[model samples]
Target: MEQLVFYSLGLGAVIGALGVVTAKNPILSVLSLLWTFFCLACVYLLIGFEFLAVAQILVYAGAIMVLFLFVIMLLNLGTSEAADFDTARAMGRRLPLVLLVGCTLAALSILAAQQVGGTSDEARADLRSVGSLTDLAQVMFGTYLLAFEAASILLLAGTVAVVMLAKRERRKNAA
Candidate 1:
């Protein structure tokens, strides 16, 4: 059951990512990104990482996506023209390169699947260790402090950049 959930989450994320890439409308792309984040949170839940799952949903879907949508709306991004067929044709020239990369990724995924078989009882037990919010916090602060701090700094910088970019220009009226 857990394996099935994991696979569903993975497929959902992939499809959502494709939707984000292919959707011409900026709003639709942002919505697809929200779906992608939700699926990832679900995957975390399936793995018994409840705190992580909640944090993912709260930080990503709740805060980040809202901020993204607000910025898109504020900037009047809806009026941008869609990509033309000529652009698609140009992009088609890279098909061979994309296929090569896809093949390499598929090979790596196959090898990873072979190496990491179905989860055993011990693996399940380990997942239960940090299932609680308190345990998850302990692990985050103790084991993953550096990664956590880096992410916080990255978020802070992104927020500042967005605010600066969204500022409007002042214009003087001719008498």
Candidate 2:
């Protein structure tokens, strides 16, 4: 049952990722991206990464997707014509080949996951203990504090850069 669910979620994630890449409109691409994020959270839940799953949902699916949609709306990038994106006709033309490739990739992914996840019960328990949020926090703060701080600073720098770029465009428009 668990393996079945893992495979299902894996397939959904793959399809969602393909949708994100192949969708014509940016808004549809964002929706596809949200599907991918949700499927990833489910896969993490299956692996017992409760904290990671919740963070994925709360951070990426909730906040980040909202931000993406807001940006799309602000930029007015969602008025794409249907004639420009005839996905159904394309899929109908190449349906068999696409299905063959998709199934092949999905099978490979499941096999890979099974091979990687074939550790003994004891090893898995040890990993769970080490991977718990509290244990992870201790290691991150105690052993990798410098790297963590550096990453935070890098992200802050990126945020400031984006804000500056947006304001620069606005200043020009106002002038």
Candidate 3:
């Protein structure tokens, strides 16, 4: 039963990821990402990490998704012009490379799963305790507090840089 559930969630995650990749519309891609995040939360729940699951849903599925939608709307990307892409030609050129990469990733994932699956019941108990909300909070606010703040600062700097570059390009085009 557990294996069945795990496979189902895994399949859903894969499908959601494909949707995000294949959808031409950014909004649709974001919605697909939301589906993927929800499936991730479900997987966390199945693994006995209730706090992590709730945090995933609340942070990624709710707040992050809302922010994504807000930014998409603000950008006013109402219509996307079709790219001058030759799908047949591009597919012919890239098919082999894509297939090779996909196969490699699949093999790696199988190997990783095998390695983790070899863990004993005792290790799983430790993982459960280590992954608890209190432990996570301590790590984030105690041990890694400086690192966490630095990451946020870096993200803010990147955002400002992008906005400035966009404004500069807009002004140049207008002039």
Candidate 4:
């Protein structure tokens, strides 16, 4: 039953990722990415990482997706003009390389899953403690507080930069 759920989530994630890549509409792509994030969160839950699952939903699906949608709307990229057949041709040419890389990644993921499944029950118990919210909060707030703050500041700076650039471009176009 657990394996079935895991595989289903994995398949959903993969399909969502493909939709994200193939969707020409920016909004559709963002929606697809959100679906992928949700699938990943479910997978995290299945693996007994409750905190990670919540964080994935809150951080990626909630905050990050809102930011992405804001950017897309700000840029007013509703629909892009067709790029003739050049883009299709280019994708076709790279199809084989993409397939090769995807196959390799899939094999590695299966191997890693097998190794994890082979871990002793004791090791799994220890992982549960590590994945606990209390331990995570302590590590994040007590040990990596500075790094966390730095990352927050970086995200703020990036948001400011994007807004400034967009305003400047709008002004230029208005003149």
Candidate 5:
């Protein structure tokens, strides 16, 4: 069961990564990136890192991706009629990079798996200690309180900046 979940998440990450590179439309790419984050959250879940998984979903998938989509929509990036795919150019640029990144990630995963070996009962116990939402809230509001507050402030600033940027420009007529 664990192996099944690991393989599924690995495949999902690969597909999402490929979609981010190969999708011509920017909106599609953003959606792919969202999938990538979601797959990562799943990977965290498979390892019994429940708090990390929920944070991955809430922070990256919920907050970050929504901000990305909003910025993309606000900028109106893909509306130009002249924008079209240059398949040869895209393939030439992206293929080697993709292969290199994939190889590196595979190597790292293998190395990490070898180091961690199989899950132990001890590890499961430790995971359980920090697994619940209450445990997460305690850590966030206790040890990591300052960092959490800073992140909220940053998000607020970003929201204000986006609103200012989205305001329509006024044109003046010549007298």
Candidate 6:
């Protein structure tokens, strides 16, 4: 049952990712990415990482996707009349980079699996604590509190700057 669910979620994620890359419309691509994120969250849940599952849904599927949709709408990128998009040409151009990245990821996955398999039971038990919300909170608030706060402030400042620049641009265009 668990294996079936895992494979189903994995398939959904792969299909969603393919849709994201192949969809002609920006909105449709973003929606496909959202679906991929949801599938990933389900897989995380299946693997006993409840915190990661929730964070994946809330952060990537919710906040990041909303931001993507907002940018697509703000830029009015729904139409492809002005720009000709040759899917085959684009894929050809990126094929080498994609293959390189896929190979690198495969190597890293094999290495990680080997390391995990060689670890003692005690080490593996300790690693499982990493997925616990209590451990996550402790690490975030206790050890990396300052860094976390700094990142949040930086994100806020960036948001404000973008909004200000956009507003100024709109006003100038209106005038």
Superposed model 4: Cα runs more than 4 Å off: 82-87, 138-175
Using all chains and alpha carbons, the TM-scores for the candidates as numbered come to 0.64, 0.62, 0.68, 0.73, 0.66, 0.74
> What is the number of residue pairs that collide in model 6?
0
Name the weakest run of 10 consecutive residues (lDDT summed) in model 1.
Answer: 166-175
Model 3 has a clash total of 0
Query: How well is each residue in 16-94 modelled by candidate 5, as lDDT tens digits?
Result: 9889867778889989998999999888877677888888999999999999999988988863542445457856888
How accurate locally is residue 13 in candidate 6, as Cα lDDT from 0 to 100?
Answer: 95
User: Candidate 4 lDDT, tens digit per residue, 1-175?
Assistant: 9999999998999999999878888899999999999999998888888899999999999999999999989988745453442387888998999999999998999999788789998988897778878899999899999998899999999999999987897789889
Q: Which ten residues in a row have the lowest lDDT in candidate 4?
A: 77-86
Give the clash count for model 2: 0
Summarize candidate 6's per-residue lDDT along 46-131 as a digit string, tens digits: 76788999999999898989998888789887557425564678778989999999899989989998999999988987887789
Which model, 2 or 3, shows the larger lDDT?
Answer: 3
Residue range 51-150, candidate 2, lDDT tens digits: 7888899999999999989998897875455454567786688889978998999899899868668978888788777656787788789899999899
Mark the regions of model 1 whose C-alpha exceeds 4 Å error after superposition: 84-86, 118-124, 127-132, 139-175
2 or 3, which is superior by TM-score? 3
Query: What CA RMSD would candidate 2 show?
Result: 4.6
Which scores higher on TM-score, 3 or 5? 3
User: What's the TM for model 1?
Assistant: 0.64
Question: Which regions in candidate 6 have their CA more than 4 angstroms from the true location?
Answer: 81-84, 137-175
The lDDT for every candidate, in the order shown, is 0.83, 0.86, 0.87, 0.89, 0.82, 0.88
Query: How many clashing pairs does model 1 include?
Result: 0
Candidate 2 local lDDT, residue 94: 81
Candidate 3 segments exceeding 4 Å error: 137-175
